[model samples]
Target: MGHQYGKKGEELVFWNSQKQAVVSNWIDVEDHKFEPPALELISELLTKPRNGLAPDLAVVAKAEAQLAKVLDVYEARLAEFKYLAADNYTIADVLHLPNLQALMETPAKKLIESRARVSAWCSEILARPAWAKVVEMKLKAHA
Candidate 1:
C-alpha cells in the first residue's frame, strides 16, 4: 500500500496528505468543540482496557466520574437542542458512538443511562443507519 503512493509511499505520509480532506468533512475543529473531551473519555474508559485484561476498577471509577461531568454538560445542552454540538446531528455526536457502544458492554454504561438527556441522545445517535452499518462492519471484520 505504501509503495502504491510513490517512491516513499509511507502510509503515514499518504495519510497526512489526505486525512484533512476526509476529516474536514466530518469535523470542524473550530466549531465542534466537544471532540477532545469525548476522545479523552473514550481513551480512558474504553481504549485503556484493551491490554487483554479487565479495566482497573479505580481507573474505571475515575473515568466514570469524568463521564458524569461530561454528561452533565451535555445533559443541559440536550434539553434545548437535539444533539451535542447543535440541534442537528454533528461530528460531536458521531465521535461518541463507537466508544459509547463499547461502553455498553461494560458495567459503566449506567453512567450514560442514568442521565435522561444523555440517554436520549445516545439512543438517537446509536439508532442511525450509519452507526448501524459501522456495527455491522465491525462484526463482520471480527467474524
Candidate 2:
C-alpha cells in the first residue's frame, strides 16, 4: 500500500498537500469538510502490513471473530429494523466495502454470506456501477 504519512491519492480520494510550511500556514486547520477516506484506508492498509494481504492467521481469525460480534449486532438490529445508520449510502459504506470484501476472503466470508441484510449490503455496494469500476480497475491492476 505504501501509504505513508505524506502522499497524494486521486483528487477525489485524498487531498495530500504535503503539509509544507507555506501550505500549512495558508490552510485553516478546522475548515475541512471531509477527511479523506483514501487517507484513512491507506493508513489502515499500511498499518496492516502488505495491504493486509499477509495478515497473521491468528489476526485474521481474531478479526473475523470481532467482526462476527458486529455482524451479530447488525443482524439483530435488522431482524426488526433496517440498514446501518440510514437506508441509503454514505462515506461509511465506501470506507467499509473494501474491508468487507477483504474479510469476505477469509473466515468472515461464511458469517457475511449467512447474514441476510449484510449479504444484501455487500451485494448492493458491489453492484453499483462506480464501485464495480473501481473494483475492476483495482483488480486488473492487481492492487
- On lDDT, the leading prediction is 1
Global lDDT for candidate 2? 0.50
RMSD of 2: 11.7
lDDT string, candidate 2, 72-143, tens digits? 665774565344433434333455566655554544467678989878777777677877888799999986
Q: Give candidate 1's TM-score.
A: 0.65
Task: Count residue pairs with overlapping backbones in model 2.
Answer: 0
Candidate 1 ranges with C-alpha deviation above 4 Å: 1-54
lDDT of 2 at 19: 23
Per-residue lDDT, model 2, residue 104, is: 49
80-131 in candidate 1: lDDT tens per residue?
A: 8876545555444566677678766666678789999989888888998868
Q: List the residue pairs that clash in candidate 1.
A: none
